[model samples]
Target chain A: MTHTVLVTGVSRHIGARVASVLAADPEIGRVIGVDTAPPPSLSSDGGVPLGRTEFVRVDPRGPDIAKVISAADVDTVVHMSLVSAPPRSGGRALMKEQNVIGTMQLLGACQRSATVRRLVVRSTTAVYGSSPRDPAVFTEDAEPAEPPAHGYAKDACEVEGYVRGFTRRRRDVTVTTLRFANFMGPGVDSPLTRYFTQPVLPTALGFDPRLQFVHEDDAVEVLRRTATEDHPGTFNVAGDGVLLLSQCARRAGLVTVPVPSSAFQLMGELARGAGLVDFSPEQLRLMRHGRVVDTTALAAALGRRPAFSTATAFDDFLRARDIAGGLPAALMDLLTRAVAR
Target chain B: MSDVDRRVAELLALLRRRVTGEYEVDEFGFDPELTDKVLLELVRPLYRDWFRVETTGMEHVPADSGALVVANHSGTIPLDGLMLQVALHDHHPARRALRLLGADLVYRLPLLGHLARKSGHTLACREDADRLLRKGELVGVFPEGFKGVGKPFSERYRLQRFGRGGFVASAIRAQTPIVPCAIVGAEEIYPKIGDLRLLARALGLPYLPVTPLFPWLGPLGAVPLPSKWVIGFGEPVRTDEFDPADADDPMVVFHLTDQIREIIQQQLNELRLRRGHAFPPFF
Candidate 1:
């Protein structure tokens, strides 16, 4: 059992939920939430009781993270601070620093610490890279036919490389990397999320690749299990089954505007420029070819079955989206049914 | 309610149920509903009218348990896989949908790949085949692969080497019977005369066949020849007699594979003699 855990990226929704869940567990001795900013208060009616987690302000990219880890004498470290999108101001350079440089410093801190025995890093399936030549389902051991072209995917690839290096040096530490599919749930912000949230969804003409999603709750639960348990090695974390991109849009109640691949590329750039969207080129590639990861190891080796499948998670996200938009429960139900049909 | 309204309501019910809870889909992303709605519908016409496919020995396929359907793959554009899928669904007493193993190229094409999955086709991998068999689902294999599909017109109906007998090993491991399937009249559909090597490579295709009509008549030439098709399913080769450990024995796998190949090739010869001609009008 893990005692006195340090959870990074607590300012984010997933990190905060994980931190709170850990705090509520009677077996865990202490819960420390670390981020550059103060964590938002857990709502009054939240499942996990508030005020149990001790908040610490520390940037993972800086040297102070080491001090926090040493001072707390944390036995387990859950790194969830990896950014999925580029910052509005500094863009690529800033994202690289936050993801790559931040991971290096965090790993450096854990390497020097005598108390830390377990480390869990949040990664994405983007490392596999979408390509026409890729296999139908990529096993954990499959090499990327084409390396990540740019942005978060390339950075994620680099971050994983560094983590592997850390593993080689500190063979004693149990390193678990969870490569998640596109996260879809209430309050999760991602490029795909933004695309679907829009009233009109643009798709590449004549292309509808398979898509996968993991509910935010399942994503958080898997992280907690990894921190509390002792599963090692890399695992692909995605809910079962897949949906076509068109199916996703129809479920989301969005109007799909099919455009040629070249025109869609131009529109993506223009949309980003106009601040209407942040559609990255790599994401565009993903939309066209679609990406899916095999989750056999996640269940067989890691011993965790997700509560939701891809279609259910997506439906739940849509349910939440419709409800938040002020549709009554019954009408939302009817709308979901009608759209699904 | 009127008939249209009732259909609308039923449609709504289906959508609502699909959105509400988790139902089961196989590991390869098979969707029975969509398969019925789209893929089978598209193939039904070709299977029934265009090709006029006639199937025999349908009883050989087990009703309740898994069996491997190993067939000779032909036609430059391989419609044999789809035809077999329809035959199993329509002709067999069990009406079990055969999970046809497909090539990587099938998965590479965006729209084609999506439809293939919904239609219960998966990558021709050992892991998928093993899992499907263990689940007691009937699985189909076209071991001849691109070699049989892309062979020249002169080599029509000639059986190619089955790839290393991986399917036999999978069947042995799963303890499932292997049913040899032979598809006649598929070879003459495309009549592949030449291979456009440079164009095929540039297009990321396995091989671009230059049929007599193709490249001369443009897209119109690409239509299939509508040759009469016959599918024969041979008796199951029992793998239960061999210990599951024999799956690892390469020699056993090879011998079994060769035996299955001979069965299929012999069936093909018999089918030709029975039909009397490669293309018999309105037979």
Candidate 2:
């Protein structure tokens, strides 16, 4: 019983990699990579070529997406319709519209179509939001401290709510929502990576919040497993362990400038104007109070531990970017050598 | 290498581990290496010399198993918790680290929160408490919270009402024993004479304490009074006798909470008499 999989947001790196992975799977009969634009020189972080995945230039916001879903007899719809890169034209507002509306329209199609039974929506841990009052480790069932006021976190929140509603509409669909930690490693560009790679990283003043990172390869593998398998439920997918924001800086060799949180946002706006990094309210909130989610459920469902821990994933990121032996790392190495002798 | 050089190399190696971020913090962010090498080292002097903290019933605290150490919170500055850590780390035969459950305010600050986590302190939330207990780690809690810390000088030794008996429930859930801890000298360290509610509200603190030397002496006054402290650990109150399901039963939780509270109060009374003077004649 081979399956035809329809993957949305195929133009993006993660989406393209997911599509290509499915396309290469022997169990998958056909793979339809649907997005408004074609995938840009697509391949996974592991160099898994985007060879067999068929690209269908279709807007998920329009009815044509439903037509394509029906025509292809797609059995699994991998919905990762997210755009988190720096603002290009209309900024956050347009991205919000694209994310929420695209998700809504795609859900409508999935709910109506008989062929669509499996739904894998790529969500984020950002939905949990950051705060001093929240739990140290959030299990999947834990309620968020408070819904995010605005930014991509809010958008992810709304998108997840839609995903929940989709579950009710189509009871037969095996819905798997993965709230992934910030993805890191080479062959990827994210806000966290951008911030770390910058000559000087600006941090929230007086805070050295604990952080977690999921390697891009691990993320891709988990996405692939969830999409192909029958695991039905929202699971927090993150590498084991945690890192401090300051440790990340020391490892990345970036000088950190501490800005008061009130003034931090203003500094963010200034950086945005200079085309350095776009810092949303949610991101700033994370810098102030970092999030750490429990991945016990994921481990139970997947039947294995992630290959990379948080520390190792960070090390991979530094190595891939050729950022080995940063400030503290180099200094520590020298001290260790002299002492060892 | 000479003996001095060998020791220097060992110290430098530890420094390298810390500087290179080679240390591991538990899931709760308790850096054992840092806690043992740095935090406890800093607090030991105060515990031994300044507080001159004497211990009783060290035999009651389990050698290697998970147990909740419930204590009375005092000292206007809340140094009792640190002293408690030093007591367990230095006095206990196994030198086990106490993973403290802190108030939300401890985590709301900047460097304070970072240090709290590194020292194995977390917000006194039910989930974290239960998690630590399940991991078989010793957890310390000051159930009195701010009320115990902020009480006026007149009401110094009296214990405040425990907050809904959360620590008791956590102990039950973990099916571990609760070691009732009583610290006698903490209440006298900074005799809180007054509280300014307006300033407290403005600063978003629980209470703006006016100690005898605090405002009058400025920064110099912040130093705690050198009192002869006695930390007595009462016998372990076994929660394993009851079913773990009892954690949900409010009546059982209430009963256990009162029992533990009474044990600590009784211990405090006895220890207070034993110490005789806040600034002891022996000192």
State which candidate has the highest DockQ.
2
| All candidates: TM-score | 0.87, 0.96
User: Which residue segments of model 2 deviate by more than 4 Å?
Assistant: A42-48, A326-341
Per-model chain B TM-scores are 0.92, 0.97
Interface RMSD of each: 5.5, 2.0
Interface RMSD for model 2 amounts to: 2.0
**Pairs of residues at least 3 apart in sequence or in different chains that clash in candidate 1:** none
List the lowest-lDDT window of 10 residues for candidate 2 chain B: B19-28
Give the poorly placed runs of model 1, Cα more than 4 Å off: A40-50, A132-135, A138-144, A147-149, A273-275, A294-304, A323-341, B1-27, B195-204, B215-218, B240-250
Give each model's whole-structure lDDT: 0.84, 0.85
- Over B1-283, each residue of candidate 2 has an lDDT whose tens digit, in order, gives 7998889888887876766677777666678888888888888888888988999999999998999999999888889999989889888999988989998898899778878988988888998899889988899999989989888878877889998999999999899999999998998889998888999999999998888898899998888889889999999999999998999999999999998888888898999998898986755
Tens-digit lDDT track of model 2 for A1-341: 44898888887777878887888899999998887776765233434367688888986667888888889898898888777643467787778877888899888888889888799999999989988888788889888767687778888889999999989888999999999999987766777887888778888888877888898889889989988889999999899999988777766666789988778888877877777787777888889888899999999999988999999999998898887655676677787686667
The CAPRI quality class of candidate 2 comes to medium
Scored against the true structure, residue A176 in model 1 reaches a CA lDDT of 97
- The TM-score between candidate 1 and the true structure equals 0.87
